[model samples]
Target: MVDILILLPIISIMIGLYFITLGLWELREGVNRHQYIKYMFTGLFLLFILTPLVWMMVNVLL
Candidate 1:
């Protein structure tokens, strides 16, 4: 339990980065295909990347 808690933030940050990378990749694919929905996905993934940071900040602030 303690180990899981210690690693949670690190794991989440890594997952967030992964999503950001995927978002960028999808953005490129969208541009190549000239699709608008890809922009939405890109935005979503970017938001996901920020989620962990935001969560950490809020926890710290509170």
Candidate 2:
């Protein structure tokens, strides 16, 4: 539980980065790169969501 609370947002950030990479890949040669940029932002937004969860966990757990 403690580990998860600590790691979820970190993991989310990494996942977000992965999406960004995908977006960049699309930008380099994809016909529909803008769609991927949208996906990247979605991931980034989701990562933001994870931050509060981690914060709440810290408040509750310790």
Candidate 3:
């Protein structure tokens, strides 16, 4: 959990950046505003789930 707590924000920011990029692309493609926000939030939620798994994998590998 300590690993998770510490890593979560970094992972979230990286993921958030992805969503922002995707949102921008979609916006250029004329995607709806609602859908844009949805994808961004989904990415954030995924980050929350992925961070702990990533930390565990790194610890195991190294």
Worst 10 residues of 3 by lDDT: 43-52
Question: What number of backbone clashes does candidate 1 have, counting pairs of residues 3 or more apart or in separate chains?
Answer: 0
| Candidate 1, lDDT over the whole model | 0.58
lDDT of each: 0.58, 0.75, 0.71
* TM-score on alpha carbons, each prediction: 0.50, 0.66, 0.48
Candidate whose lDDT is highest: 2
Say which candidate scores most in TM-score: 2
Locate the minimum summed-lDDT window of 10 residues in model 1. 31-40
Ordered from best to worst lDDT, the candidate numbers read 2, 3, 1
Q: Is candidate 2 or candidate 3 better by TM-score?
A: 2
lDDT by residue (1-62, candidate 2, tens digit) is 77876777677778877777777777777789678779778777766776667677777877
Please, what are the lDDT tens digits per residue for candidate 1 over residues 1-62? Answer: 55655566666666656655665676677655434345445545545655566567656655
**CA-only RMSD, every prediction:** 5.2, 2.3, 6.4
lDDT of 3 at 55: 65
